[model samples]
Target: MKNIKLTIEYDGRRYLGWQRLGSSDKTIQGKIESVLFQMTGEKIEIIGSGRTDAGTHARGQVANFKTESELSPLEMLNFLNRYLPNDIVIKDVTEMSERFHARYNASGKQYSYYVWNDVIPTAFYRHHSFYVPQELNLEKMEKAAEKLLGTHDFIGFSALKKTKKSTVRKIEEIRIEKNGAMLHFTFIGNGFLHKMIRILTGTLLEIGMGKLDINIIDEVLANKIRQDAGETVPAAGLFLDEVFYE
Candidate 1:
C-alpha cells in the first residue's frame, strides 16, 4: 500500500462540508472517495488536514489516503477530476511517506475571512463575502486583532457547545488587509477550535463598527465565556487558505 497526498480546491456553497455524511448528503471528501473507490476497487479512508464547516470554502485543503493501486499521481488526479463534481477539483496528487498523516503532521493552518464593506453589496461577491453595510475602521480592526496574536486559551472565541479536549492554540499571526470594498482578515495558527476564526472576526468587526470596545478583548479572554465575545460570522465568508506541513 502507498500513501497519497492530494491538494484540493472546492466551492463549498453546495455541499455539507468536507467529511462524508449519510448517503443522502453531498460532501467534498465523499465525492473524491467515491471516485477513488470506483477507480481502484478498494475502500479507502481519507484524512483531511482539518474540517471546514458547512458552506466554508477551501483553496489549498490537503488530505491523504492509503491505497494499493499502481496509478501514477498524475493519472489519479486526472481520473478523480473526471469523475468528481465540478464544484470540487483535485489540484494535485503525489505519493508520500507512509508515516505522513495529513492532520497529525500539519504544522499550521491559515484562514481568511472576507467581508464586503459598503452601503450597497455587489452581486458578484455576494456568494463569496459577508456583506456589512456599516463603515469599518480598518485601523481600529488592526489594533483589536493584535490582541489575538501569540498563545492563549481561546475558549471565549469558540463555539460554546463543543466538547473538544482542549482550547489552547497558538496564533502565529493575525492580519487585516483591505482591497477596494473588501476587507480580508487572515489568521495563522497551530490549530483552531470549532468556529474560532469566525467568532474572532465577528469580534473584530464589532470593534471596527464601534459596537464593542477594543479593550473588551482582555476581559473576554480572562472570562473565557463564549457570550463575552462577538457572534459567530456566517460560514460562507470563511476559507481555509492553506495548510503547512514538514
Candidate 2:
C-alpha cells in the first residue's frame, strides 16, 4: 500500500465543510472520496490535517490516504483535478512513507481572515471576504494583536462547551495588515480551538472600533471566560492558509 498526501485549495461557498457526513455527498471530503472510489473501484478513506467550519475556505489544506492502487501520484492528481468540482482543486500530490499521518503528524497550522473595511460593498469577491462598513483603527488592532502572541489558554476565544484536550495553545505569531480598505489578519499556532480565530478577529475589530479595551485581551486570558470574548465572526471570511507537518 502507498500513502499519498494531497495539497488542496477550495472555495467553500457551497459545501458543508471538510468532513464526510453519513449519506451526505455535499462535503469536500465526501466528494474527493467518491472520485477516488470511482477511479480505483475501492472504498478510500482520507484523513485531513484538520477540519474547517462550514462556509470556511482553504488554500493549502492537507490530507492523506492509503491506497492499493498502482496509479502514480501524478496520475492520481491528474484524475482528481479532472473529476472534482470546479471549486475544489488538488494542487499537489506525493507518495509518502506509511507512517506519515495527516492529522496526527501535523505540527502547526496558519489561518487568515479578511475584512473589507469600506463603507461601500463591491459585488465582486463578496463571497470570499467579510464586509464591515465601520472604519477600523488599525493601530489599536495591531496593539491588541500583540497581546495575543505567545502561549495562553484560548478557552475564552473558543466556542466549544467542553473539551477533554488541553485548552492551552501556543500562538507563534499574529499579524495584521491593511491595504486600502482591506484588513487582513494572519495567525500561526500549534493548534486552534473551534471558532477561536473568528472570536479573536471579532474581539480585535471591537478594539479597533473603540468598543473594547485593548487590555481586555489579558483579562480574558487570565479569566478564561468565553462570555468575555467578542462575537464569533462569519466563517466566510476565514481560510485555512496552510498546514505544516515538519
lDDT of all predictions: 0.91, 0.93
Number of colliding residue pairs in each model: 0, 0
Best-fitting candidate, measured by TM-score? Answer: 2
Model 2 misplacement above 4 A: none
Model 1 spans with C-alpha error above 4 angstroms: 160-164
Query: Model 2, 55-136: lDDT tens per residue?
Result: 9999999999999999998999999999999999999999999999999999999999999889899588689788999878
Question: Considering only N, C-alpha and C atoms within 3 Å, which residue pairs clash in candidate 2?
Answer: none
lDDT (Cα, tens digit) per residue for candidate 1, span 63-161: 999999999999998999998888899898999999999999999999999999999888998888999999888898898888888888888889856
**Model 2: ten consecutive residues of lowest lDDT:** 121-130
Q: How far is candidate 1 from the true structure (C-alpha RMSD, Å)?
A: 1.1
Q: List the residue pairs that clash in candidate 1.
A: none
